[model samples]
Each structure stands twice: as structure tokens, then as C-alpha cells.
Target: MDTNHNKGDKSFKIPGDWIEQSKQLKEKFSTLTDHDLKFEEGKEKEMLERIGNRLRKNREEVLNIIKEINLS
Candidate 1:
């Protein structure tokens, strides 16, 4: 599946239920803000970058977090 985007972004895909996933992320990292999790359909790279910056994590780390959250 077309997972990564053109800029070599890791964890670019937001879960189908992002509202719930975003809630989970916020709970895990209380400092995360709505703006930090704001995702545009065609702007996954930007969103992941923002999230990685806010969480002090790499793209892969953010990907794993999202994967785990989706699994739960």
C-alpha cells in the first residue's frame, strides 16, 4: 500500500478513526494540543512533522506510536 509519501515521510497515514487516535495521543502526551494533531488529507507530512516535533520523537517513533494506538 502507498504508505510513505513523496518526501520520504514515515508514519504519514493517519488512522481511519483519527478523532479517537488523537484523543489517545493527547492522553498519552498531555502537552499535545489540537493544533499539534491537526491533519489535512493531503498534508500528512506536515502533520507528522508537527507531531514529531511536539513529541520530541522521530518519524518512525511517531509511526510506531500510531500503530500501537491503532492496535489498541
Candidate 2:
């Protein structure tokens, strides 16, 4: 379903509590939608691309944003 063909950000992995983290991201970044935050196995890069594109950021920024969110 992910149309991102960048083949980059291969080292990125979704957090264990990605569902919760995703909610936090959605709140922090209103432009992000459920579809953009959706996580499928082995699809981290694609999801990152969607998030980065929506937020007008790069892959690293997106990765950092996801890492900065706390699941607590």
C-alpha cells in the first residue's frame, strides 16, 4: 500500500509501542493522519516517507520525531 520507493531509511524500526507513539505524533503533528502513521511490518521506510512528506521534513527528522515521543 505504501507508494514510497525511496529504498532509504532501511535502518529505521518502529518502536515497540508504536501505536501509542503514533497517537502522540498525530497530536503533535496534526497534518499526520491515521493512514500516514499506519505501521506495517517491514514498511517502516514507507511510513517514514509519508510522515516526512506530510511534515515537510527529511527522513532523519521524521525518525527523530518518532524517537522523541514517549509512550508513557
Candidate 3:
């Protein structure tokens, strides 16, 4: 998997194809709304934060979930 590390953190950049993953996330977590998964070109962090908040998870957990979806 191609990943970009965040400064001073183990957090990897959200995949460029996050929109597809976001769809899977919504299917997995029905609580997530379209607005919650909305993606912008340079707003990856914001998107992840929004998803994490909705799922009551941390950023790393959110990233892991996305990665898992990609693997499937």
C-alpha cells in the first residue's frame, strides 16, 4: 500500500481512493451519513476526523478500518 506518513506521527495519509472506502464504511457503520463521508481534495484529515468522531474512534483506528476495507 502506498502511504505517506504524517509529521511526527504514525498516521498514514488517507488513501486517494477514500471515497470508495467511505462508501464501505457507511455500509459497515450505518450511523455514517453522506455528509460525514464527503471528501475534498486536500481535506483528508478533516474527513478522517469527522468519521472518527462519528464512530467514537481515534484517527489510527479509523485508518485501520479503512485499510481493512481496502484489503477486502
The 0-to-1 C-alpha lDDT of every candidate, in the order given, reads 0.85, 0.83, 0.82
Kindly list the per-residue Cα lDDT of model 1 for residues 1-72, writing each as its tens digit. 775455563335675799999999999999789999997888887888889999899888988889999998
Worst 10 residues of 2 by lDDT: 6-15
Q: Number of clashing residue pairs in every model?
A: 0, 0, 0
What ranges in model 1 sit over 4 Å off? 1-7
Model 2: colliding residue pairs = none
Report how far residue 17 has shifted in candidate 1, in Å.
0.4
User: What is the C-alpha lDDT profile of model 3 across 20-41, one tens digit per residue?
Assistant: 8878888999999998888876
TM-score for all models, in order of appearance: 0.82, 0.80, 0.76
Q: Per-residue alpha-carbon lDDT of model 2 for 1-72, expressed as tens digits?
A: 888676663667676788888888988888899999998888877888899899999988877777779534
Scanning candidate 1 in windows of ten residues, the lowest lDDT window is: 3-12
Ranked candidates (TM-score, high to low): 1, 2, 3
Looking at model 3, the pairs that clash are none
Best by lDDT: 1
Candidate 3 clashes: the total is 0
